[model samples]
Target chain A: MLLTLGIIGILYVGILVLLALRARTDVKSSNSYLLGGSNLGAVIGFFTFAATLFSTFTLLGMPDFFRVHGIGAWIFLMISDAVMVFGLIWIGYELRKKARKTNYLGMSGFLELNYKSRFAGIVAFIGVFIFLLPYIAIQIRGVAIFLHATFPEALPMWAWAAAIVAVMIIYSEIGGLKAIMYSDVLQGILLLVAIWIVGYNCLHHFGGVTAMFEEVEKVNSALLSVPGPKGLFDFQFLLGSMIAIVLLPYTQPQVSTRIVILKDIKSLHKMAIGIGFFAILVILPTAFMGMYGAVLYPDASTSEFLNMTFISDQSNLIGAIVMIGLIAAAISTSDSQLFALGGELRSILKGDDEKMVFLARIGIAVFAISSLIFALLTSDELVLLARTSFAGTSLLAPMIFTGIFYKNAPNLTVIPMVTLVALIIFVASLLNFIPNHFLGIRMDLTLLAIMTLFALVCIYTDRSKRGGAIEN
Target chain B: MTNERIWTLCKIAVVILIILTFTPLVTPSGIHKPAFMGLPYTLWVGILEAFLLVGITWLATIVHSGRHEE
Candidate 1:
């Protein structure tokens, strides 16, 4: 445990030092700090986007999901991610075009300027904060739980959570978004390498990939098929999940910000394609790991399965490195989210650069602390928690889509009203005031459909009203 | 090809991808009974779909970006 912690400590400090050196203390404007001066290249852009989209979820949640659920887990995440990457090509082009037109600062600020209403921005900011805080907490808590399960004597869960949040907050403060993006490049590479290394080891233990799956089939044929032993991955669930993920870059500011920061449309295009490949490569190995778990520890609990597979099954050095990789994945994602929340706050503030930066830093600390609190409070269902976050933020999708595609939307007030109502309905469902699925459809999909129809009505109403005024 | 034509094709490609996901092409029942390439039909189809999207995106980039110099 000490050796593991020592190695991770060295890597963490090394990354911080690299970022500190890369940090532009000369960032004289909020633009430089917030958007990295919109100068990210295709490589960094792709890595940052990929890293932000994946996290400890890919490392921890996915293997367990594949183990518990089945191939449907692949359809749930891999296919959805693929669709999202394809969508990004066009959306990135259009969003960048609009950003150039609107002098975009942040997601909320973009909405505010386009709608010509501060209320729109505030609603967007609130939506992000409400959804993202829990999501960030999940990432922090995921690693905390894993580490706690692995080393019961090392540290308490809250300490692990706080340590990550503190490191994220401090690193994000020093290097800002640029630092986060740089670290993402490192994290992305490490995640890919670490997963494959561990996956290879797991596969080797069972002879090979096919041999592993064959063993899984022998143990439980259901494990090798769709929906696995559990029917969690049904049509509606996968469909709703795909929509949420496809809308992710638009709704998640950390991801959307990366989209906007690419140097050019072509760069964004390349980044999108690269991410599709990354999704495939990163997710394929988790299936191997999952198959290994299915054969070795079919009846084990999620934590036990994870602890045994990641820690006990490997050499001490490899296990320690893999653990650090898990930590890296969690912190990489948490920092981007924490920093993006700060960016959202910066967008809503009306102060000068210095004042806004100061306040945003303070906001980062506050939000991190809040997320740490949530990490302590929430249960350890990482994938479902993440899905809820995705579904929640996706309620903002119609608002953002309208702002992106339409020149004139109905009363700016109407969209936010629709958004707020949909949010209420969704939250009620989440809180069990209402059922989460109705007639085999997820509440989120139902709300998204209703909200989209409302948006269409607003657009048509605005168009007709304009036509009538012109006739007059 | 003209930039407009390329973008139009790209849009169509995206629509097709969306339709594919919604269709039984991705459903387990669609490819569950057969094993082509030593994997479940649904699984390979999903993988192929992802590859096709990436392929399309790459081609679209080449086509659309080619005209950027014009």
Candidate 2:
């Protein structure tokens, strides 16, 4: 197993280096370095978007989600993803049209320009930064903790985290977004192959799909139904999750950037359809692995269950491949997020292109280090933590939609201000400074509804004021 | 109908599908019988729903007014 892991790990690193060097250029303009030349085609766009959106969360967190939460995990992620892809074709088209008219560098800068308020950009930046850092941290933490558990004698958990962050920073800094996208193609394929192999093996353990459910039924019937044994997937939770996931392409800068950089609407539409398929293909296997865990390691801890199912039960070569795939998943998502953060910073800065790009590069490094530290400190609830990140970023949706859809967005600066307050309140709820629910509704859903309504009212009032002025 | 009308209909269809997903028809609590091919009720239904959505999205892309735009 050690030899196999060594061979695969070295090969993975070798390919990453080659890709990074290939992507390197003498010119380091923001457009090339940060936005990957802003002309992505369908195939590459699909892989990069898939790899970024489904990461260690899918590979690591999801099986555990199914194991504990039941088959509802499928609806929670796949249904939400299905809706999100549709949204990509619908609202995403409008966003691309609006963004292309500006010198779009990031969502923050776009909002700043459209809203005619620097505060709007600051709010956007701060909202993403606060939410995204934890998200990036969880990706690193997920893979790092798993590796440490798999090879307890090899490296400390924080050391594993630091090494992953180091690799991410090195490749992304050297090659930029192009390198990351190229590596995403590799990661995406490896992720698919590794997951299917393990999923098949897990399914084969029970002989067939029907037999598998029977075994799961014998262990716990709740694993076959909604809300599971823990009652985690109730209507409110699933609805909030769906809303957050659908808004992700617009509200999450990493994803939103992908939407804008596609070479054309044709590519965007193709990519959206491709991702919809990819979502099902990727998530379906985790359900197999989850059911496997439910029957075999139902009482085991997360790491214990993952280790038993993914490594201990698998062949040496398969385990090594899965390990590399997990690392690839972690790196693929984290680098894009850190790079997007830097891009967000660059979008807001008003200076020479070279200097702004330089500053943003530094910003990327700082963000990566911050994530590294947080990875060591953060808890290991991968799916739930990721859901929080999605929900947190979704708070920015009303403000962002107003920026994209409303021509009178400049007069609607109140939306960004309100978005900022909602963000603070949401964070407070997460920190337990406030209750997680208000009047039996989740804080995130409550805040999103309020902010969206406020935005609509603000737009209507602004339009009416203009109407009165025109009449006078 | 014009492509624009088709696109609008696709959007409305997706909204209805999403709304129905939360109801007992798709994700009824504590019901796992009526299994198809040994798959549980919600899991198989949810999978079908997801495929339906992607299928709708595919159709929408074909009729999308902006599909011809560069």
Candidate 3:
């Protein structure tokens, strides 16, 4: 299995490198490099968006989530994803309309440009860097831990992480966003194909889908209901999850950058619906694998269940495909995000285009190294860590939302205050300084509600004052 | 449809979908009493809801572009 996986990983990286080499000549300017020259069409746009949104979390974290929790896991992911797709249509249209009127390179630059406030971009960049770094590390660590478990004697966890980061940086530097998008197309296809094959095999192992669920129900009836066996999927938990996931494209730089790079509104619309379907297709299979785990390895730990189901049970070729797919998932997401961080830096830098691009690459290396260190240090729950990143960044949602939709800006003080408070609350929850769920409501949901209400009140007050002045 | 009208309707549709997802009206607790086609009823409803979302968004896009051409 290790030999097959190693050969496949090398071949996959080689294909990506060749693709990057072909795209290198296209990167004549920093704008072109960061934004893909704004030439992405429906096919590439849809796949890149899908690839970036669903990653190792889908392959590893999600099935484990389902096995440990229950069926509510489906609603937690699919519903949120469906809503996110619809959101892209409305948000994407407005964002693109705004982008066309300015030299929009990244979200931070857009915020700074539109609000006419340097601090706005600074706060935006800080919030993204803080929240997204761990999210990137989640991808890195997820794959590293899996590889370590698969080959206990092969190499250390950090070595696996460094290798993945090296691959991501080399390809990203060579081809820029263009190479990433093209590679995303390949990664997305491989992910969908590999997941379905494993899913079917798992289903066939038991009698069928019906028999599998029956077996799960017989073992633990909680697996079939809301707030499953562990009671992890309560109403409030699902609500908070929906909000975080729906706001993902707006808050996450990688997905949002893809939103702006599409060629036109028509492509964006097609891509949005296509992504919605892809979400359902990709997620349903994970549920199947989870059911397999629930009935067969009910008492096994997360890594144990994953290893048994995804690796030990499969033949050599299938195991290699799954491993490569996992690696592809990690790289597809990590590179998009790391590149977006570079784009964010480029957006804020005040220098010549060449110098700005050069600095941005350096910034990317810094971000990747930081993520590697975090991956080595922290290996928390994947889905929960990802949720924290989402909630933290969603605090900046109001800032960006107002920047795009409203003609008049609110008090600049509100942006940083909201961001600071949101991050503090999330970090506190992570450290157990505050409860994750307060009185049955998730803390992140409560935080988002408070932030949105604050933004609304400020907007209403400012608008009323302007209205009174106009009347007078 | 003008941009304002189209965007307002899109927002309304999205809000409705969200409410459906969160409310017990479409939840498995409400719907998953029986298994159908190898899935709990809640999953079936969720799938249907997703398709409805795709349908509405597609229609909105068409309306927006149709108005543009007009």
Q: Which candidate number maximizes TM-score? A: 2
Kindly list the per-residue Cα lDDT of model 2 for residues A103-122, writing each as its tens digit: 88999999999889999999
Candidate order by decreasing DockQ = 2, 3, 1
lDDT of 1 by residue, A85-137 (tens): 87777676677767766566689988887777788888899889989988999
TM-score of 2: 0.98
Every model's TM-score = 0.95, 0.98, 0.94
Give the worst 10-residue stretch by lDDT in candidate 3 chain A: A463-472
Candidate 3 lands at a TM-score of 0.94
Candidate that would win on DockQ: 2
Clash pairs, model 1 backbone? none
TM-score of 1: 0.95
Docking class of 3: acceptable
User: 2 or 3, which is superior by TM-score?
Assistant: 2
* CAPRI class of candidate 1: acceptable
State iRMS for model 1: 3.3
How far is each candidate from the true structure, as Cα RMSD in Å?
A: 2.7, 1.9, 2.8
Candidate 3: segments with Cα more than 4 A from true spot: A26-28, A410-413, A434-440, A468-472, B1-13, B28-31, B65-70
What do the candidate models score in CA lDDT, each in turn? 0.82, 0.94, 0.82
Clashing pairs for predicted structure model 3, backbone only: none
